[model samples]
Target: MEGVSPEPLRSELDSKSKHDTAKEDDDALKDSTEAEVTKIRLMRAFVESRDPSSKEENDLMMRRFLRARSLDVEKASAMFLKYLKWKRSFVPNGCISPSEIAEDIAQDKVFTQGLDKKGRPIVVTFAAKHFQSKNGADGFKRYVVFVLEKLCSRMPPGQEKFLAIADIKGWAYVNSDLRGYLNSLSILQDCYPERLGKMLIVHAPYMFMKIWKMIYPFIDENTKKKIVFVENKKLKSTLLEEIEESQIPDIYGGQMPLVPIQNS
Candidate 1:
């Protein structure tokens, strides 16, 4: 027999869902506007002190500017704070049989790296290499691990500050890689998914194991406030370790940090 006319209840439910979605969007816009107003009131004009007399001063200025530039991250920060939040390192602090420790002494290598012709780490060189292989992410991540470790080892002791990089390579990504990363993040309910959205896809010359200084941008407000773009040197080092460790877990997920864990 032919189907009867659809029930009024079904139509009403669909209409209600769309109306609710629209109202929610409208409310979000209003909240965002208010936040912008608050931000304007708290901000002040300043110049970028790219060249300062001392390295200490130079680092501090760079740190401040990066912090100031970071967009509202209240959502991202709140969600990550709850998960066992301890800074991680590539080598476990307590592991009796430690991983291989480099023999080279930490020098004042900051003077040597992280800059361009006028003094910058060949960020573009790092980025260009991203597409050189099939596993672009994995290549980048390993590059961070290698380069940062070398930098840290070379950095002079008692230096309170270190270099912070936002290389063009870090922000740029391949279409296929980007889609895969975003998809994995969306399915993850409580994980630091924003790190995926905000991940500084670095194109370091040859460093990160895959996810270095990269946190999923998907997070809550209070938690996001803690996300510093120029991650504190300790945090940067520690996060690198954690991301690396997570990538090469013993008998765990068969996925590398730079490579998409999805197909695996």
Candidate 2:
């Protein structure tokens, strides 16, 4: 998945350089940080100024759009409006209820797997379990949004992104649906934006590499930087770098089991 932001602008708020020393210029760093904050405030004000909804325009939600567009106010505003319009049309009820996604949820292809060391939510998807159905491409998009909403609900303060692990152990040519992947990617990268932290692909077979090459060009460079491919042998070590072993599933050499999604 990908968004519109340039690499530097995307990390302006969250990343720091390792070359910095005790003699580093504090004033310049402070100024840069202040400017980013100002942009976020301006973007929030711009959106709230044109709309009448009082849902509280905090930095967290508005930052998603700002970061999505690389902090360009005009583009970010347009993206934000487009999101609101899409949400209104796609989920007119203001929320996607369980009944709306009953069919997709029944597959149990996706589920929340607790939080990582940084407090970012971890969502696991069994790619082998996902298959294209006669219901068509829209079903996949709805399922993507449903999984997103479910993960977002578990986010607490100071957390703005989530991690995803795609278990492609049994994934094959039959399970590879390019259209579904593109549509879902568009929804997440364009409609959602800046919500993905890292996407770890575990148990990726040689055949999946060919499929990845096809999908690679569609992914944004910034988003590509967030993806990591791990061999089954090294999956545990790689995941344990960012996620605690206790929070990971037993299938990945961790103590936790694959928790079932509880119906509400």
Candidate 3:
């Protein structure tokens, strides 16, 4: 864990600790809310850059990070408010669940010891200039979920029976136009039979693809194109490229249990 990022562990879950039932608006908490926003940014940058020797080490670091949280600090309600904007902010709106997913996956592999060696983030970076959420105030915000299940890897010799898994996370913008455009233009647009149009969607579990493709023929042409299938390996590499190979806190927790889909 020497070189690993601790951003995720250091994140601003302050507001989430307590159920924010302040239904009536409180404009009074506005000023300090902005300050917490700054800390969130700082902490986010810290978490995404955490690099560890192996997935196990990364997992330990994350566990520790979670335990280190202090309840004294107040979470920025304003930040969650950004989720209401949907045009420019990057936050959660509603959850995207695969209609059905694997109950679980195998575990206990030796060679791939740490998080980095076994983690694969299923990410989708859309080119949306503006977006807004259809889900109103009552909607849930999006967050990343990383799961690892013991899995077979295409390795050679003694390393052949390696374990690896999918780490899936969704990024959203709040108070931004970019969010709305992305959902409308890319995801919910099409009846693209082969949701796995390219290797882009391979990271998505089998059930998601199945439902996505099943409803494909009902969507339009342009939207279907956005539902591309990408390789897990390439997605991470691309992130590295974008940041000039800088380490971010996105670590692999456990082995991701992937639902196998037969290639079309």
Candidate 4:
């Protein structure tokens, strides 16, 4: 009797302890959210101070950079500023015109017709149809921007990424464009962070694997995770896993026809 508290007193103490623990957890969560918000505001201010002409800047865009940089405000700010500078110089007129990339578009290699299960827009590229342009790297670079911007425009609200399918079935050495591939990787990774939802490489032959091996090293770890090489035997079934059969392109045994990127 002398060693224990009364039953009523013990019950009241237990309830108070539980309430205190819950309050502590709530306070911690609130503090963490406020800290993140503060960081985002600081980053927005810093980026705007450096690039006042960034009319398209907003919290969502800033958040993308922040997430890409693991929420490091300084690093995200620097990356965002670099992107702004590159966009200003490369896209001086504000957007890449179809006429400017007419040759690449005429190749009809790139198409976008449907969305994945996640609602991300789909982009299909027929590598066999793409030949290295006589106009050099600049034209191809602009073409990449054009295609990417077009795909981005098609994204629905709240969706920030798109899916890619590269059909290299008939690809040969003649279709090889190492510089073009490197430029594309650089632009996608550096300029358009977190924009690629996934990339499906279909019917990739032995020669293509060698090219991929070379290109693979340049891909960042995060981007590399999104790439998938579908087996020939399971191409249709594999594609069906992430895309509705109706939305898959006819060429891949799905219902939809391939719409050229320029047209879509």
Candidate 5:
């Protein structure tokens, strides 16, 4: 008892302990962030080494790949490198031009309008309007890239992903292009990892299910989870839940008119 500290000294010690704990937590967080930054730097270096001509990609883009691979530097690096290779070969010009996809552009099927409630850019595709081109699947593939690039360009600051609405109200077997669908899926999941915030497949007829079944197996598990087949009756209400009425397109019973991807 003689050596014991008084109550005021004990209270001061307790306060100091709490302060130390808080400082430790903050230091830990800072260290974690620094470590991640280092990893991103390493990933960027690896990508650039493989693709000498690669335009410098931003940290946020690298972070998307890193997160997709659970922050495993090796896996993220590999994925990012593959993307660079694909871009170099597929989009040799750096960006898909409207002229290259003139036929698909003329279809006026793809549109990008206002942002969703969460600020993600909205892309609406009329599946019925898509038909297999006589030229081949390459044109469609380029069109997909063009549309995606346009959507990415429209993304608001701090928003990295986009919302897509696939309206298949009149889609029939004649419009089916399995090759194009598969190719588009590959580009989205492999080349553009983590870029899709959500996709609503509205008015998906029973016939579409057959094609979907074949395509579903090829989709990444995470991507499959983001795909929602909106019920016909619930289309408007369900969309309103995630998108504001003002942003919804006129065809879907909302006010906004669909802006062509080339123009949007």
Candidate 6:
């Protein structure tokens, strides 16, 4: 009994099951490859049908559109085309020079610094420094792009995400501009999909929490999941766990200094 092998029929069944599983895995892989090929063809055809002379045939660009639209070919194509149109109008020169929004850069409100432990960039926003003005909305929008561009420029290969910390120290009703906050959130969450890794709201006052309740409903569930509220007591420890002490600023009980971008 100690040396007994499995019965002949049971051994054969086990062998057959292993072979079946291997074959199933192979078939699944082949099916996935074929589906990807078909999707690429469909994406190209859709773009060509709309713009015969289009030069956007890169697979990465197509994949970005697919991701933006959840891999629906028709929707992705439309979104890509619309993006092209918007890009042309928003950035006619295909670039946003630092000089274009010099005044906005002077605000010293938003700036992205060192990377976290996961290599994701860190964006720090001082709400107390940001004040809404009627004539500054457009410039502020450009500044948003400028901040994104700065962070994106710093992104190393294979890194596609970033973190944010909104410092609400000294923030009051005068600093709370509901319309501006919504617009900025939309630009970051909607226009720039899949970029945010997390957004920590630190030192939020009771009044700020009340404002957040109103604005929270407008945020998508996916974006909402990326947000976290940390009280002043926990701010240092919570941030230190995710980011390096040198990377974080002294204002947040870290060693780093908050240096505003002098030129860009």
In candidate 1, what are the lDDT values of residues 1-264, reduced to their tens digit? 257556776898889987775565345334344544344223211121221222222222222222333533343233323221221232234121212212111211111222211121211112322332244443333333344343334333222122232333343344224432333333232322221112222233333324432434553353344324433334335334323433322212313222111111
Separately for all candidates shown, the number of backbone clashes (residues 3 or more apart, or on different chains) is 45, 0, 70, 0, 0, 0
**What digit string (tens of lDDT, one per residue) describes model 3 on residues 156-246?**
2122112122232232233233333333333211111111211133255444444355446665553344444546667655434322222
RMSD per candidate (Å) reads 21.3, 12.0, 19.1, 15.5, 14.2, 15.1
lDDT of 5 by residue, 5-28 (tens): 699788998899877755643453
In the predicted model 4, the residue pairs found to clash are: none
Instruction: In model 1, state the lDDT of residue 220.
Output: 38
Where is the poorest 10-residue window by lDDT in model 5? 23-32
Give lDDT tens digits, candidate 4, residues 37-84. Answer: 778789988888888965456565676677678789999999999999
Error of 6 at 73 (Å): 3.1
Evaluation by TM-score, superior candidate among 1 and 5: 5
Judged by lDDT against the true structure, how good is candidate 5? 0.85
Reference-based lDDT, each prediction: 0.31, 0.75, 0.29, 0.87, 0.85, 0.74
lDDT of 5 at 46: 79
Candidate 6, residue 20: the lDDT equals 75
Stretches of candidate 6 above 4 Å error? 1-45, 48-61, 134-136, 261-264
Give me the displacement of residue 77 in model 2, in angstroms: 1.0
Instruction: Please provide TM-scores, in order, for all candidate models, with all chains considered together.
Output: 0.24, 0.82, 0.22, 0.85, 0.83, 0.76
lDDT of 2 by residue, 22-86 (tens): 12433222434565678877877777777645244345556677777888988988888778778
TM-score of 1: 0.24
